[model samples]
Target: MEPRFLLLSDVAAELNVSDSQVYHMVRSGELPAIKIGGRGQWRVERARLEEYIAAKYAETAAWVAKNPLVDREDEA
Candidate 1:
């Protein structure tokens, strides 16, 4: 079974991004995460990660819809 929470490295690996990038996202509150243990290690909830991905997909779709691709033939 999949884990309920994931380490920052795991999240970074899944997103194909750097660990620092994920850390920054968490710091910026763009991606929800929690600090645990005496060492204050970061962990992201599985459900929250899924929600973040879905939100990104929706955000990208909105951008694409707003900025329609123009046909190059019209310029030629």
Candidate 2:
């Protein structure tokens, strides 16, 4: 079966970003994560990560609505 959780590096790879950036997002509470390691390692739930990505897409759509582009320069 596929894993239900992923390491910080795995998440970073999935998002195509640096591991540090993923850490920052988790630290900032933008992305949900859990600290389960005895040495304090972090892990992310696959469902939560998918939710975060979907939220970003929603946010981008909202931004587009707020700042629409004209079909032609002359129409602006």
Best by TM-score: 1
* Candidate 2 lDDT, 1-76, residue by residue in tens: 8689999999999999999999999999999999996898899999999999999999999999999886797786
Clashes of 1: 0
In candidate 2, which residue pairs get closer than 3 Å at backbone N, Cα or C atoms, i.e. clash?
A: none
Tens-digit lDDT track of model 1 for 1-76: 9999999999999999999999999999999999999999999999999999999999999999999999999878
Shift in Å, residue 70, candidate 2: 3.5
lDDT, residue 75, model 1: 78
Worst 10 residues of 1 by lDDT: 67-76
Instruction: Give per-model TM-scores.
Output: 0.96, 0.89
